[model samples]
Target: MKITTLTNPRQTILLTSRAGNKDNVMTLDWHTPLSFEPMMYAVSIAKARYSLELVRSSKVFVVNFMSCQFEKEVLYCGRHSGKYIDKFKETSLEREEAETINCPRIKQALGYLECQVQEELEVGDHILFVARVSKAELREKGKRLFHLFADKFTTTEE
Candidate 1:
């Protein structure tokens, strides 16, 4: 009887944001498109997460779609905290300036969506951020990463 397993095979993404001079990236499995009329997106982030405050203050974030090649980076970001180390520096994940937002996007990501926070509400221990897509970058097609409980990942590659 494992609840985590029930939510298995979920999409994994790298949520990036910048508050003033600080930038951070975290692995997120709880996010989705909430609307189509206005092209809205939402992400569920814990209150204690370092990126929560950054997103709150900056009111902007980028969702980086990682491919199977970035599995190591995805896992590394999930295991480490931005409060302790510079994830980009430690992981050597390159960054590129987002077109519509002040934050940066992962250069290695298969694609990226720049979002501006439109609304926020508390959902239990997590804050649900509703955002509007301001810009997007789609790179070469690749296998997207999906979380399959714990440290396991499933991809469309093979």
Candidate 2:
């Protein structure tokens, strides 16, 4: 049997946002649940990324959990920059207004976590946005898509 050692563990998701009418999406593997009372979550995005700038200015974002059907869209959004192209238009995913935040949520996702930035920490190449969950909705209880080894995408059994 071959055993593999893993250091970091997180399910990559599409962090979508819009700032001043500019909408963008970024792939983020750095995310974790921070609290349960207020339902806080955190995501780390590089300062140079387009989504980071949007989140910084808007102070809000939607964490959309991808499904197995969105593998192509995930890769496209992750590899391409929203500054040059419209990611939403490129992908088949749909967007909807969040209940509490100013950002938009992916309507096709199994669920969404809407948040408002609570704190930001400057970490080496990325800025950690610790946000307080303003609202959450589970449209479907399907499996969640995850990225491993930076390329492979897999789904969890529900």
The clash count of every prediction, one per candidate, is: 0, 0
lDDT against the true structure, each candidate: 0.90, 0.85
Which parts of model 2 have CA positions greater than 4 angstroms off?
Answer: 1-5
Clashing pairs in 1: none
* Candidate 1: tens digits of C-alpha lDDT, residues 93-148: 99888989899899888888899999999999999999999887688788899999
- Candidate 1: segments with Cα more than 4 A from true spot: none
- 90-140 in candidate 2: lDDT tens per residue? 889888888887788898888889999999999988899999998887788
Q: CA lDDT of 46 in candidate 1?
A: 93
Query: How close to the true structure is residue 52 of candidate 1, measured as C-alpha lDDT?
Result: 93
